[model samples]
Target chain A: MAESRHLGDIILKIDHISLSFGGIKALVDISFQVRRGEFLAIIGPNGAGKSSMLNVINGVYHPQTGTVTYKGETRHHMPPHRAAELGIGRTFQNIALFKGMTVLDNIKTGRSLKIKPNFLMNAIWFGPARREELEHRRKVEEIIDFLRLEDIRRTPVGMLPYGLQKRVELGRALAAEPDLLLLDEPMAGMNIEEKQAMCRFALDVNDEFGTTVVLIEHDMGVVMDISDRVVVLDYGRKIADGTPDEVRQNPEVIKAYLGVGH
Target chain B: MIYRETGQYKSNYGADEQIFPIRQDRIGVMIILALAYLVVPFIGNDYWFSAILIPFLVLSLAAIGLNLLTGYAGQLSLGSAGFMAVGAFAAYNFMLRIEGMPFLLGFILAGLSAAAVGIVFGLPSLRVKGFYLAAATLASQFFIEWVLTKFPWFTNYSASGVITAQKMVLFGYAFDTPVSRYVLTLVIVTLLALVAKNLVRTRTGRDWMAIRDMDVAAEVIGIPMLKTKLLAFAISSFYLGVAGALWAYCYLGTVEPQAFELTRSFQLLFIIIIGGMGTIVGAFFGAAFIVFFPIFLNLFTSTVFAGQLDPGMLSHLEQFVFGSLIIFFLIVEPLGLARLWQLGKQKLRLWPFPH
Candidate 1:
C-alpha cells in the first residue's frame, strides 16, 4: 500500500512513436511520459487517433518506429498480454467485456496472473487452488462493492446497461491492480450523472489506488477538471502537452479545438 | 416449496463457492447419486444396461469433452470420435503390449494419448476459429479412422479389423457381469463429471470462458490465448478418450475404428448443442435426451398404431420424428435443457405465491 502512495518515477514512456497502416498514418512522432500516480488525459477531435494511441500503449499495435519504455525496460513492439504482465491494464473504446460471464467471474478473470494454475489441484478443488480461489473471490467481492455492483454481481454482463457495463469494465481493470490503467472513452455515451460517477471513480482510482491513468476522452470540461496534465492530439500529431491551464492558453491547442482563422 | 434457499446463510467463502450452493440442490444430487449407485444396478436388466444406461453414460462423458472446447473455449471441434478412437485403440495397445497393465491405468494412459493428439490438432485453433476450426478438426476424424483401418498393427494382425476388447479385471476380480460393468462405468463417469465440474469453476475454466467470450479482452487481461485454447483441447480430448475406452471395453465389448465414424462426432456435437453448451449437467441432459427420445418415439408409435404400420416405415418415422424434435428443441430452447432446468428452479422458488 505504501509503495502505491509514493509515486515519482516515469512508469510509461512512449518515445517518438510513429504508427501507420499502409498509406495512412494513425500516429506520427507521438512522444509522452506518464509518471506514477498521474492522471493524464488525451483529448482530441474525432479521427485524431485517440484510440489508436491507447492501443499502442497497451501493445495492441506495434508502432513502426520508436520504442516504448516501461519500468526501465524498452521495447519496439510488445504483445497485449506482455503489456498486461508488465502491470498495464486497458478498457476498450467500444467496451470490450465478457458478455457471457457474470460480473464476479469477469472481475475474477482480472486476477488471472495472481494465482499459479495447476490442473490436478483445480480438478479436485483442494489445497492451494481452493484457498487461492477463495482469497481472490474475497478480493473480487471488494471490487464489486467498490464499484457499487453488489446487486448485479451475479447478472450476466450482456444484460447490464451500457453505463453499468462501463463500470464493470473499470472494475475488471481495477481487479488487475495494474500500475497503469488506460481508459478509452469511459464516460462516452453516458448521461451527466453517470459521467460524474465515472469521473469520481477515475479520480479515486488515481488518488486512492495510486494507479497512473492514461485516459482518452472527448469531454473537454471533464478532461480539464480531473487530469493532472493534458496531451492534445490532432490528425495523429501532438499539438500541445502540458497542464490544463497552460494548454488552454496555448494558441495551437485552441486552434486545434476551434478552427484555423481564415 | 421445498426448492427454496431462504435460511441457508453461508458464513464462509468456501461454503458459498460450492458447486451446488443450495441445500435442496445438494440433497437432490445426493438422491440422484443414491439412485444411480444403489438402486439402478439391482433394478436394471441387461437390456436396460446395454441399450440405454451404458450408452447414455459413455456419450455423456464425450459430451462433457465437446462442451469444454466448443461450449467454454469457443473452439468448434468435429473430431471427438477421433479422440475417443485414439483412446480406445491406445488403451487396447497399452494393455496388449505392457505385461500386467491394469485396465484403469490403461484408461488413464489412453486419455493422455488422446490429449497428445488433441494438442496436435488443436494447433490450428490459434490461427483459425468457428467453422474453419471445425473443418480443420475434421482432419483428425478421417486421419485417425484411416490409420486404424489401414494399419494391421493397430488390430494386432486381426483380419476382421475388429478386435475383441480385453477382459476387464481389477485385483483378479472380473467385471464380466452387466451390473458390475455398469457400476464401474458409473463410478468412473461420476468421478470424471465431478472433476469437470470442479475444473469449470476455477482458473482453467475461467480462462477458457474468457477466450470464448472475447479473445481480445482476454489477451489484454493477460490470459494467454495459445496456452488456454490448447489446454482446453487437451483436457476435452482426454475426457473423450476415456469415454471411448469405456464404450469399447464396457459398452460395446469390441473395438472397431469404423465404430467412431464422422457421424458419431456429429452425434456428440448434437449432445452439447441440445444439452446446453458450457454446462457439465447439460451433457448428461443431452445424452439422456439423445439416447431416450428414439426409444420413446418407437414406444409411442407401437402403442398408438397397434401393429398397423410396417417395421421399416416405423423405423423411418422414428428417424423423422427424432430429427424434428432436435430441430424443435434447438429453436425453442437454444441454451439447452440446463437453462430450462434453471428456469424451472426459478419458477419453483416463486411457487405457491404464483409470482
Candidate 2:
C-alpha cells in the first residue's frame, strides 16, 4: 500500500483530551495528530470512544481535560460553529439531511458559511445576495458533478436510498470546501458495492481537493485500504496509533477486538 | 401544447435562480398581472371590490406571514391576530402623531413596530418548541391585544377603542374610491408577495427550511439558530403588520380591536393549513377559499329557499357548510388546495404522455 503520502505539516493536534458525561467517561487522555492532506481513521469496538474523538476534534463535545490546536492557535474551547468557519466540516454518524429539501439545496446550504449576504439583501434577492447566491450555486454544482449526483439533484433527500443519502451528505460537506473534513461512520449501513463506492469517493476527495479527512468507523478493511494512518482505542483510551500496517499488527488492537466484538 | 416549455433551457445561474424559470410560468404570471392591473378595477363594482377582493388580498398577505413562521420555520404560533392588532394600532398612531408622515412610510414604520413586538414574543421560542411555543405565541397575541385595548393612547381615546383609518394619499393623489383602493391593494400585495416568493429561495429562507426540517442538524451546519429564528419572526410580523395596515386603511376604514381577534388568528392559521404550507401560491388559495366559499354558499342557499328562510338561519347554514368544507379539505387533501394546483401543473408539463 505504499503510495505518495501527501502528508504535510501537522494541521490539527489533540493533546490528552478527556470527555465525560456525569460519571460516564467517553474519552480518556487521548492524543492524535492529523497531517495535511491525509486520511486518518479512528477505529475501535463499540463504546471505544471512537465517535467521541471526532466530536471532540470538531468541538461538538467539550473535553474535560485537553486542548485542541488547529493551524497554529491552541484553543481550550472552540465552538463547533467556529470550527465550521475555520474550514472544518463534518457529517453525523446518523444521516442528518434536511428531509424536505432537494439534493441541490442540501449541498447549497454548505456554501452558506462562505456567502455573507445581509438580511435586507437576502430579503430583496438583488445586489449582493443575488451575486453571492449565483457564486455559491456554481460551487455546489461542481460538488454535485464530482459526487455524480446529477440524477438526484432535484430529489428530496428523504426519498433517496440510504446509500445515495450518504453521498448527498458527503456532497454537502465537500460543498463547504473545507480544509478538514470529519466523517462519522459514513459507510456504516452500506453494502459491499456501496462501501466500495464510498471508499473511492473519500479517497478522491482527499486526493483531488487535498482536504484533510478524519473518519471514524468499525470497518477494518475500508480503514486499511483508504487510511494513511489509523488510531485504535479501547475502553475510552488510545491503545495504538501508527500507519495502517503498524496498527493492523499491533497486539493491543487485536486483543481489544478479540475481547469485545462490535 | 400551447403552454409547453420543453424548448426553454437555462444557461446560467442567474437564469436558473429565477422564481419562475419555466417560460410558461413567466408568461402566465405576466398575463395574470396585466389582468389585475388593467381589467379587474374597471369591471368590479363596490361589493366585489371591498367585500371579496380586498379581504382576499389582505388575508393572503397575513397567510404568507404565518406560513413563513409556522410553515417554513416549523415554529407554531397562535398570536398572529395580536401582531395584526399591533400593526393596526401602531399605524393609526403614526398617522395621528407624525407631522406630514407619508401613508406608505407610516405603514412601514408600523410594520417595524409589529416586528419589534413579534421579536419579544418570539424570544420564548428559543427555549421551548412544539406545543409550548404555540402557547407562548398565544400569550403574546392576547397580551398585545389587551395592551392596545387598555391604553387610550393607542386608539386616541376613541369610542370603544376604534380609530378611523386616515386616507392613504401618496404622491399627491388620494386613494379614496373603491377602484383606487383596489388598485393600491393589488399593487402592494403583488409587490410584497413577489419579494416574499424570492426570499424563501435565498440563504436566510433555506436556513428557515433547515430549521423546520431539523434544528440540530441546522445548528451543526453553522446556521446560527438564534439569528435565523428571530429573523423569521421579524420578517413574518412585518408582512402581517402591513396586511393589518391595509385591512384597516383600505378595507375596514377603521382600526378596531374586535376585527383582529382570536378568531381571525385561527382563520389565518387555517389559511396556511387548507391552502398548503411552505408554498407561496398556497396562501392565495387558502385566502380565497376562506373568503369566497362562504359567500357562494349563502347566495346558493337564498336562491334555493326563494328568500323565505330567516337571515339568522341562513347565516348559520353558511357557517355549517364552511365548517364542513374545511374539515373535508383537511381530510382529503391535507397538503391543501395548492398541492392540487401543483399536481395539475405537473400533469400539463407532460400532457401528451400519461405519466
Predicted model with the maximum TM-score: 1
Report fnat in order of the candidates: 0.84, 0.63
| Segments in model 1 whose C-alpha atoms lie over 4 Å from true places | A1-7
Q: Can you tell me the DockQ of model 2?
A: 0.70
What is candidate 1's local distance difference test score?
A: 0.93
List the DockQ of the predictions in order. 0.85, 0.70
Best candidate according to DockQ = 1
TM-score of 2: 0.97
Clashing pairs in 1: none
- Candidate 1 lDDT over B1-355, as tens digits, reads 9889999999999998999999999999999999999999999999998778999999999999999999999999999999999999999999999999999999999999999999999999999989999999999999999999999999998989998889989998999988889899999999999999999999999989999999999999999888899999999999999999999999999878999999999999999999999999999999999999888888999899767988899889889989998889888899999999999999999897886
**Worst 10 contiguous positions by lDDT, candidate 1 chain B:** B302-311
Return the lDDT, model 2, position B46. Answer: 92
Tens digits of per-residue lDDT for model 1, A26-107: 9999999988888899998999999999888888898999999999999998889889999998998898999999999999
Writing each residue's lDDT as its tens digit, candidate 2 over B210-287 gives 989977667767888888899999989999998998899989997678788999999999999999999889999999
Span of 10 residues, lowest total lDDT, candidate 1 chain A: A1-10
